[model samples]
Target: MGGNELPLQRIEPVSVSGRGLPRWLRRTSGPVALVLLWHILSVTGVLPSEVLAGPSTVLSSAATLIETGELQEAMWVSLSRALTGLAIGGSIGVTLAVIAGLFRLGEDLVDATMQMMRTVPNVALIPLLIIWFGIGEAPKIALIALGTAFPLYLNVYAGIRNVDQSLIEVGRTLGLSRLAMIVNVVLPGALPSALVGLRYSLGIAWLALVFGEQINATAGIGYLMANAREFFQTDVIVVCLVVYALLGLGVDFTVRTLEKVFLSWRPAFNGT
Candidate 1:
């Protein structure tokens, strides 16, 4: 047989792997390409001048702010506020979720009130927060906490309540105490859901920063955006927004990595 004429039966299929790149990045490439195209159009004057800012302009503004330490200071303030609020809101939300999930009356008592609060926008409460806490870090943190609490509460509550009855029965049959069952069975079952809630609450805390900056005297990405808005500095605004997006992505990625590392028992984190 000629060397070039290899039989199909003799050859094993060589699989080409999409390794060295995350599946998410691969999936998002299409949208990123479109964004690049839009950016190019904006730079070339194809898009409306007022509505869209060129990437270069935004990058230049960001570089200037970074060089001047404005970006760093703003990032510190915003991240501090976000983390503090997340701690407070997440703690309370998880506490309430545990209480409500354990006791039926707790859910009944809190549900309607939480529903009412959920309907109320964090921005709307700014005036009242100012009156109560003054124009300080307290009010800003409180606002973020308020915005963050509901999502965590909802998700954690569902997680707790949705724990498999069969698992509970199995624990009971095994002669496990109530607390033991909760720790071993209920909490584990609910952990994945609670993680989802945690990630979501973190996002909401960031979102509430918009309302926080409007009232607060100074500092934070939100403040930067507000200041940029006043001067019609669209590039600065865009830069701050881009930073916010990156920070959110960073936080989410950290959370996801933690979940994968710690909760490997769950199929959701099987690396498949």
Candidate 2:
């Protein structure tokens, strides 16, 4: 190469197969295919409208519900119940986890009891809840709280226990106080596991909401579905089911966003 001339760099062709499709298209293809098949079956009478509504019918019903504002009202009520229950359950779970994780005495007192309680199905407590709190909102919210608490407790406790011993030693060498060490090193280290617990708790919160609303609920998506069932409005029922799915998806996305933000310090694997 001449002193005044730039070296010719090797130019490689970009791989078309990997880059051709947009990520959104690739992600949506499976659901789109399933929907198309559903539409075809609905039109061909292999799937009856009475038994299950097609995607188009469901969409139209959702639109109608939106225009009427009933869907929005029901959604707000349902969302409130789910969030309230989550807050109560999550607070209790974290508090218990922290106490038990930090002290041997606390663990002895709390962990075994929690383990025993966790095995009992939340649904089995519904009758007792109804008797204790009556057929009102209390029973429903309590059911949700009971359902969400255990998964969070287990995960957070495990996370705290799993914190690296070397990091604890480093804190000791730095002469960090117990509170400071926990705040700066331990909590941060345990955050990824806490977030995992949060995701699982959020999913259970929705499921609990479903069963909770079944107990003489006058409002919410479950009520809407129950009413639709009486009239055989399969389209409306499908719309409610879709709404539940979309809400769960939205919350999961929120958690993933949180992981990106809070857990950014840690390295993670992204599949090829």
Candidate 3:
């Protein structure tokens, strides 16, 4: 082969923009466009009415709901539940993860229970929780905490348990105290895994929110969707679903950004 023909050139791929927007539009791509196309076609009377109502009708319905401030109120209600539940659950989860990592007795006592709880659907707890707690924020928060706790405990426990014993021995040889060794070595070593637990726990928090808001809630996004269903307003349900999807994406983004910031010293593939 000639020198130039010895090897062909390779071109790096350039990602395309979708939905007349950036490629990062994520789940909004094909479905949103399809919905819009359906709406355009339907409103122009180009399609059979038996199939679906198009975008313009949905938009007008959405606009009407927004104008009455119901959407805003429902959004705020849902946001509040999600945020509060996250804070409470995440705090308990991380704390427990840390403690479980540090204490063998605690790990043994709680591991089995948490493993069992992990299998129990967070939503199933709603009925019992409503019965016991009367469908208040307390039960919802507890549910969120329950949903979030296990991953954190597992990661953190693994982090602490799997610490290099040699490192501890070196610290001992260096005459470092137990607390100092743990603080200086164990914590830093375990941080990446712990943060991963925290990140995954955020998704669980949202899942718990959906269930929590379903019981005795007159305000949350879930409640709005529930009420909308009675009126056969499919678009309103879609709006709530879109909000949840966006929120989850936003939270995952935040967690990843934090990982980049806090765990910068750890190599990419070096996770626990």
Candidate 4:
């Protein structure tokens, strides 16, 4: 090869199979394969229906529930509980985080107490909650709120603390007021970590809801599962489980979308 000319190099052709498929389909391939395997096991009697229903049966049961409007009502109740809990818990967490993160006195008063409380398992409080609030919606919502609060509190506090001191210096140099510095510089810097906390809290909220609803729930996915358990309706149970999983996934996706929108200016490393 001439010094001035680039040397000829071999280039590998892209695989036709991979290139032909959509990205979404490729991402879902593992789940699809698992479903296929599940179907095979179910049909071959390797996996008993009593233990776990096949996907088809689960789908059929879900459709019937939807048709009868049972699933819709359950979903609405469950979602309302989860969202209400999240709102209440999120408010408390953020408020405490702000106080503890920004002021030494606040930290002294709040952080230690929160740290102590966080160590106690939220589920372990179920009995106390039931006694305090009864088996109605209050205990369940409170459980979810308690489960969610700590994660957000921890993450937001850490995020606020870990913010680059240089940025604070810049804000000071620019003569930004305390409130302005927090609103503009501190909050923006802490957002990514807060979003991570939100994702975690969202997952925990679902788990909490699951456990909470088991407390003599009259309506909700947990109630459906409980009712199904009595009748050995494996398919309905599976459907409820799937719904819980999907709801968690949906909230996580929503947070991710929010992160992308809010943190668009920040550069991140995409995997090779």
Off by over 4 Å in 3: 1-53, 269-272
Q: Clashes in candidate 4: how many?
A: 0
Tell how far residue 79 is off in model 4, in angstroms: 0.7
- Candidate 1 per-residue lDDT over residues 1-272, each given as its tens digit: 66898566654434434457877888899979987997989968887557767877778888999999999999988888989988898888888888888888998988777877888878888889899999989999999899888888888889989998999999999999988998999988988888898899878988887678778557889889888888888888889888889889999999998888868887542243
Clashes of 1: 0
Best by TM-score: 2
Give the candidate order by descending lDDT.
Answer: 4, 2, 1, 3
lDDT of 3 by residue, 1-272 (tens): 55675566766534322335555575568877887787778878897444444566557767887899987887777777777767776677667666667878877777677677678877777778878888677787778777877777778778887888998888899999878998998988888888788777888878888888777777878888788778777767767887787888888899889889988887565312
Q: Where is model 4 more than 4 Å wrong at Cα? A: 1-22
Best by lDDT: 4
Error of 2 at 87 (Å): 0.3
Q: lDDT by residue for model 2 over 1-272, one digit each (tens)?
A: 55898878977545423566797899999998999999999999999998999888999999999999989999999988988898999999989999999899999999999999999999999999999999999999998898888888999999999999999999999999999999999889889989999999999999999999999999999999999999999999999998898888998999999999999989787644
Question: Candidate 2's error at 80, in angstroms?
Answer: 0.6
Clashing residue pairs for model 4: none
Reference-based lDDT, each prediction: 0.85, 0.92, 0.76, 0.93
Ranking by TM-score: 2, 4, 1, 3
Q: Which candidate do you rate higher for TM-score, 2 or 4?
A: 2
